[model samples]
Target: MFRAKPTFVLLLITFIFGLIPWIKAHNSSLSFCNRTCASKHGSGGLTLPYPFGFSDGCEIKLNCSATGKATVGEFPIQFVNGDGIRVNIQRKCNRSLKTVAQLFGPNYAPTANNAILLNNCTEAAFPCEIPSILVQTHFSSVSCSDSNSTISCYSERNKRAFIDLERLKKERKCEYLLSSISAESLNTSEAPVSLAVEVVELGWWLEGQCRCDVNANCRELVSPHGRKAYRCNCTEGFEGDGYKAGSGCRKAFSKCNPAGYISGKCGGTTRIVMLVGGIVVAASLTISLGLIMCCISRRCLKWKMRRLTKRHLSEATGNLNIPIYSFKDVEKATNGFSDKYRLGTGAYGTVYAGKLNCDEWLAIKRIRYRDADSIEQVVNEIKLISTVSHPNLVRLLGCSIDYGEQILVYEFMPNGTLCQHLHRERGDGLSWLIRLTVAAETAQAIAYLHSAIKPPIYHRDIKSSNILLDQNFRSKVADFGLSRLGMVETSHISTAPQGTPGYLDPQYHQNFHLSDKSDVYSFGVVLVEIITGLKAVDFSRPQNEVNLAALATDRIGKGCLDEIIDPLIEPHRDAWTLWSVHRVAELAFRCLAFHRDMRPSMTEVAAELDQTRRSRSWGNSEDNTCTPSSEVCSSSSSSNVSERPLNFHKAELAGRRELLTFGEKSHVNLAQHILRD
Candidate 1:
């Protein structure tokens, strides 16, 4: 028998070892490019064509139910069309545009001329949600205005760039909805009726590749409707679609005579021999690799678990004495996250009242998801709570991270959230003095964070819902999930604007830069809530008054502040009560300023409030007489001012602030602040 020459054998071996995998890889890539990964749910009336993958390759898999309600991942969406998807309006609570884009991953983008609708944006000044991937700033936003209840921002670049999801989640401000529509809808006589979507239109392709390898042979295919579809093809000397699944590239003359092998052509026999040998070798190596991998995988997984447990225990729990409770202990404490023990549910998690073996009552927060955002929040709250304590700030006693279940333990606030006192429960409610004191203490606590710490902390969410009261009705600022660290060196920290819709800072929302001033803005809204006893962004009220912040600002501006004050919180018709109320109203007005620079620093706000308290005290003790320094009785001496006095009062207060400035330190500064007790 004539055997093959040594040189020919070497070449064949090299082809088997190296060239086969490449051909297979090229074929696999081509298959990806040639085939359109589109699917449709006929029952649900949902269409998933090119640019919308029904499986892994697509950024978001459009899943639809029988009822025609579409879902991207787990989020309920209204529709998915050629350009984009439309999110269901009712399902978009607490979810922002940035959050929606993130569901699709970084490579996808909202198309230019895409519309974004925000929930609870009635009071938010535009452009509420900036699509950072499309443009870094809102320079050319189309329909944003200072007081529009709803805003539409057309993408500046007509396409989204690859954005860092973690960074965007941290710094995004727009509340995103689930829906998409044709570009023509943008020019309709009116916004789409009945199906107004809060969706981001994602771009069709990624930056460097068209869902294919950079080296894959590619061609842009135009659909019958003139839409461009990118597909991959095979290159010269290669067969198949250049995709591994398509049986990858091979020689064309597969049926050539075996005699060709005598001339080193490897006709059909040599080809078959090479193929069989390659598979046999690969199968043997795969079996060996599988066994090794199984053992190594198990060992690595166990090692990683032990390492993570040690790290979390050593670092997160640390020497702070904060207990790291187990899942069983927490379960026993709350009786299995029962409704009977549940306190309430907020944006991130639910709270339940729990009692320790030591008989001390505490609140346990069981978060919704184990995503990075939620985990980061838990870590943030722990790191923050472990530090500087204050009477006005809630204490985080301990935490549990068992089996990915995140639980945070805090000293139970018995009286309930400040919101309950302001509106919901409203049993006798809080007095103006109590409300004033709460405001003062909250400010002092924030001031401590802003000035006392080397690098201050900004409590991004400073609403009434976050302020809790103990049995004695003392206020403590609760919920540090949205808190951010401030730098002493930099003027501001660029981050995603996060907070309750009604209380988010407008300027910060417009530009993803956070500062101590943002807290002052939210606190100002809280102040208004305290005085008015109304929701921050209520839509039930007349369109103009839907947003309490805007309503209060409008009323204060027009000199009619008394008309909008909550009847439940009607201040007694006494000089001091009226004076105190007026002063706080003016302070709130200043706090609600659109520009951060215009808002007073938390330190200044605490000092001024302290001065008001002192001034009121000095007046009653000094025989109720008007003194040169105390301007309680201005030229308009009538018991009732003709119109809203906050605006007029603000003008006078701004000029005379030097007189009202208190040189005293805040209570938070004086206390050996303990976040827990």
Candidate 2:
């Protein structure tokens, strides 16, 4: 039996006993161990390795040397498909035997008659592996090293390897070859290998299959030594070192970098751009809103200024002396006479520069009066003014009656009043043409009042102070506070003599009878004042020369009209101009005649002055002669002035038929005393 070793022994035994059936049977069984092992498979459906298989055709995935010993490999052990993956033998000793076992293998399987058992087990307390034996025991049938257990034959050298039990028993080896159940062997999901096994193998132990593919394992099996160890395997359809990375079953997936979405949906870059764009749009809108607010604020400020202007205009218009603004039109223009739109003030009530419904401006005179007498006078004056209309007249716009206050509206005269031009010394240089235009215009207006209007109107207060100039310097007769109108054929308006001082008719004052000649007397004084550039009765001047009319008469008789004319007239230094002025001066003297019949009518006087202005002549009309008056004159006279000493009565009748008429019996001597010499 020991003539040769195992390589030669198998050949010699096969040849020498080739015809012996029992010997051939044993040899054939030995041959079968070379290829396969026992017919029944190992646990986990895998046939054991050579000298350790459970089927006729299974062979270990390891090289056998001539001595029938397994060769070593890097990671030689691996579980079959559907087997709880684990190494086949003690990991260190069988490094070459590339076989694997189930997680619930024969070592800890239950025995036939109980709940725990072992493979090649002889004693219940100490299980041992035997190369010649197969185990079909349940994992829960046996308990080791306890009472009621089988023989306690423990040996350490045979603990992990397949230790042929007949050899150990014959060699009488005991304590060093013993083995015990590992604590991790009870974990059903882990194989009987080390805890360092791949998760795929552990997964297989739990699910009975490999979860990884071949190329993914990187030629590195993860199974190590001891219980709970399992073989490494990469996941199907993937490739990597599953055990090293601990990603045992990574599935194959596409890799992309700097690539777009296949469906053209928004990418990361596009999303970022969209977000930034949205932010920019939002910021721009915010800035635009702020700018709009600033513009709106400026616009609001301008509107406020306009509103303030309207308010001031309204306040002034409310207290004007004249009816400068129409009630309906002004109220409609300024939103119902609202207090929010006042203008200015003066001696009258508030004066307003009002815009009419027709877009024309007007000066509104609002006058205040509590007494019934004053109110009656204002109403009467308004009625008289309403009855007349002339270009030279200050046109009445309308009137307002509200809250016991009277308002007269008139067309706006942009050039202001003649008083401002004459006495106020406004900054604008007044040319002689403009001044003469004012005088000529005033004369024409007064003449029109005395001649044109039916029954004739007499402007009792005919002073530079009562004249207003338009933007074109056209003079207008304004402020008819003392005007009167009645039938010319009859006596004048039956009222107390009412007129400004120095301009009042002396004849009308002594005898309470009004006549057209009263207006002529006033015109004479105005003419003297205009030529001399002096006030009618200026108390501020030297008392001897205080009365402008008397001073002019004295100077004229002495051939001193040159010394009395306005100094501002020196620019027009022609003798013809001086002669024309002297002629007008003489006519003014005649108009102031003390004899009522001798005084020229406004028609005669206006016609003579017009002709004199046109011709620049000194021709004498019968009614117009420089006859110095001997007595005071009534400014209301436009026909005849009462004379003192000169008995021109039959003499005046010698030239004119109507000499001593109605209102002609006044005492001339008394009139002379009051004429302010």
RMSD values, in order shown: 17.1, 55.4
Give the per-residue lDDT digits (tens) of candidate 2, residues 1-677.
56658879789888777668877787777555333222233322223321233333222233333333322222223443333333222212111111222222322221111111123333334342211111111112233443332322223332232223344344432222112222233233232222121111212221113333344432222222233423344557864434432334444765332233323343646465655676688888878898999999977875665455335434533432333333455566656655654444443355566776667777776675646665555665676666677788887767755434577777888776665655545545455445555666677777788788777877767776677778888888877766666464265434445666567666665555677788888888877766666777664565456566667766765656767777765534543344346546766776676566677887777665654454322323322222224333222325365332222232332354221111223322111212221
Candidate 1 lDDT, 163-250, residue by residue in tens: 2334333333445432332232333333222212334444433233334433347655433223455444456655543333334445
lDDT values for all models: 0.62, 0.49
Model 1 accuracy (lDDT, Cα): 0.62
Badly placed stretches (over 4 Å) of model 1 are: 1-310, 316-319, 488-495, 614-617, 625-646, 649-677
* Highest-scoring model, lDDT: 1
